[model samples]
Target: MVLPVGRSFYVTTDYGRVKGFRYAADNGRPDAPVVVVQGGISGTGQLWRLDGSGWWQSLYDAFAETEDLQVISFDYLGGLGGSTTPEQPLTVEQHALAYLQALEKLGVDRIHGWVGGSFGGVLGLQAASLKQGPPIDRLTVIGAAHKPSIQSSLLRSFQQLLLQNCDCEQQGVVLARALAMLSYRNADEFERRFEHPDDALEYLLAQGERLLQRHGKQANKLFTHLTPILNDYHIDVRQITCPVQLVSFSSDTIAPPALVSELEALLPDCDSYVSIETPFGHDGFIKNVADYQTSLSQYLPQLAETHV
Candidate 1:
């Protein structure tokens, strides 16, 4: 049996140490390093869990099992089960700081590529621009944008408002889940998928549970802090020195195609950006994995190529 790579934990510039697992073939070769940035507002170490049917592992499975690559990722401080919590207001910059710390502590000098979607994509662009930390050879940002729309910000604020108004601490789970499902989904996708649903009650209940799962219970206050912050979260997409490949979809109303184009123009070293022909909506990363994989196959190798 092929042995899976060993997993481990590391400390950060915060309250508690983070837990993470890596996957790489044990042949003495230096693994073609890469990182997978998760977009969930809550914790998603499960995405990398090889034990169960994890989403990330499933995505990586598309590549060669023996493909040597270091997969390093972690839960954000404010994320569901991340080891630490920020005492102060959480900002996009602060979250990026935590992610950069993880890459550094892991001894990853540079990543061959970075796969980011939504929030993670925004952070990736910021990381590449500073041209600091690890040398990011390639950038793949999907369902992302250079700025947050006023509606997006207000939507997040409403979530915090709901959480703050509630008297119970358990309400955090509800707020987190609700926001997660709503944000996780591309609004346009919903209209398309639910038009002919048979069990309206079950679907509505699912949405409810996705949000109010732990109502009346204590929740991480970071959710409250982050809600309003999303409104102010915007990144200047130009400073990156490596090639960038953006994936835009027709149905992604949140990060519209136009915004993607505008952001693409800001990249200093971008190789190219493509808009996919899919009705998969904004959350296409999870919905349309094959389309992204096909694109990555072309993008990653080029970034890894030695020009000299």
Candidate 2:
């Protein structure tokens, strides 16, 4: 099946608004199950592209081949994408509200699944816990927990300090991103890929430079605004009534398997908890797609017969 072109739309929220995208199912079933997908803090609604440049292109490709499933995603407020820049940072609950508003605007009264990774996974938990808005039947959270880990928080706090104190803010952003790249992947990956220390340094710097080039001015503010919110996050897993599927990377220090296991135990109804073994660490969700794609495919179709 060919990937559908995404149609962009605007969603107005209480705090602000954001741009959203919808990928209609090729099966053209009006009663097709709708799935909402979200990525990390830097992620946008453009999950698939004809040129194969989408951030989640591999995952989206797998979804596109699935029968009778429509997909939607959105940019966060104050994000690099075509979203409103807020004066103050929005909390996780506020971000969830914005996502709910987007769904309502798109006439999505109920969702079959909510697939999110990293910060996006946190947003999914908050959204599913909401008392109002459409009910999500199933939730698939990858590499995220109800709260940020202590180490992850500390790292981000340092990044915030760098952004706040540095004279050259762009350089600060670059440096912060470089530091983040370290946490995103594990030592095993570095050991296998880089023959020397200089090679690893070059790779990290290049990753930071690439982000700076892609997002430009938005990079600094977006990093400063959204990065700290992870620290402020605290959710009652019992509130999320939907059956949850939790995926964690074995090497992920940011959102480790232990954190996801805790979440699984607290969730009202946990369908499954999968820990994919990969060296990619926190980035395994995107980097090691083949490893976890089967897990997602198995879970997504479990309730398909009940959706329509």
Candidate 3:
């Protein structure tokens, strides 16, 4: 399934060239309020996925669906899609600053709302903490943490090790992606999705193959660039002044609900903590889109009433 995307735009910054996509309402109102949506590391700025029926539909579209705002999304500085390679090693802080720089270039002085999933969520928090990015009226984070857990960090290290040692880099990308599937989902989901070990293996193999086939040689570089960002992500939540909404899955191993919950205290204006119960683990936010939409619909309106 391939989601259709618009022509790419570039924002050159100290980090180098950053590329992004823009989604706006039909009126083409430049003055429309803006919302930013950042996807997981594996995905590009194409917010929707092509379903099996060959239709492009966004799993998360509440922001795009809103009549009065524009939606902007971008790739990490050296990520798999859209963006180009960075001149220097990337850090989470640098990634955040890159997005801010791009937004500034785009003439977005203030963000109406910022929604990020997984690593994208971490970037959102980090950007907010910088206190130097565009003003953020509200932030919605899905399955993100202020600091990664020791377990997730170790898992990423093992992935990096696999990538570092392999003679064939694409093979390494496949293996690392397969391993990452384990962290993205929980045992219960595995049990529910597959009838047997062989079935599970087949699914993982298909996922890995799909990743390699889609990204090709760029796969390894994407993984290499993202792991460092994951390891270095730590935010000073007190610096965040915007209203925040945290949505975490009960079964997420990468960003467990407890760890995500901790952000509620540190964030000066956290408005809500929504725990979504699902066996899908870290991927629950994607797997259960309706649930997230319900929450966002209820919360985003408040942003307009109070902050817009």
Candidate 4:
């Protein structure tokens, strides 16, 4: 089922006003459950574009085909897409508050589910912990932990440092993104795909160059602001009261299985923990959805029944 054009809206957040998008389900049930979907820091509310350029197209397609649900997504403050760029970076808690405000503006009293990956996952955890928003009945976090791992923090810190001191800001963005690509995927995948060292380097450079071409200077600002926030991110899992489903990749160095396990142990009502083996590492959430789609469907039974 092709999703209809998304309706854009504005919401007043603590830092400033931001843009949001709503994809009304084809079933058009007034009482249909609303599911909030989000991606990484660079991700936008446009989960799927007709041009096939969306960041979460695969997962969004799976959700969009489920006739019983509505989907909402938003851009982060100071990040790419239609959201306002804040004078200063916002915290995870602030982002979560803004997400709730966006839902409130849309008259969403309750969320059937909140599905997020990477930075979005941590945002979901922070949102579920907040006491003053509409209740989130279920939370699904993929490739993220309650806090950034020390190794991930160190890698990101270097990226920020490169951005701060490089001769050309654009080059800095390119180099940082290239460096990030290395961490996003595991060495096994790199070795398997790039038999020659030059091939691997070319692949990383191409990925970075593509990002710059796609988002321009906005990519730099996004990395500059969001990277530091992610490096320092931490959430108290005990505060979250909703049923939570955690998904992790075995080879994910950024948000490894160990870190996710820590979060699972702390969550007040963790419904399940799923760790899928994939050489793609942290990026497996997007790259190898079929590997864990069944596990994910267990949390969303409606999606399971319909998708099958």
TM-score of every prediction relative to native: 0.81, 0.94, 0.92, 0.95
Scored against the true structure, residue 254 in model 4 reaches a CA lDDT of 93
Clashing pairs in model 2? none
Q: Write the per-residue lDDT of candidate 4 for residues 130-159, one digit (tens) a residue.
A: 876789989999999999998899889889
Tell me how many clashing residue pairs each candidate has: 7, 0, 0, 0
* 105-124 per-residue lDDT for model 1 (tens digits): 77778777777777677777
Error of 2 at 214 (Å): 1.3
Best by TM-score: 4
**Candidate 2 wrong stretches, greater than 4 Å:** 2-4, 26-31, 302-308
lDDT of 3 by residue, 9-103 (tens): 88888787888877665565777777788878876776653342201144434544455666788877777876888766688888888899889
lDDT of 3 at 160: 89
- Which run of 10 residues does model 1 get worst, by summed lDDT? 213-222
- Residue 139, candidate 3: Cα error in Å is 0.3
Native-structure RMSD, model 1: 4.0
Report, for every candidate in turn, its global Cα lDDT versus the true structure: 0.62, 0.84, 0.78, 0.84
Candidate 4 Cα outliers beyond 4 Å, as residue runs = 1-4, 301-308
Minimal lDDT window, size 10, model 2: 299-308
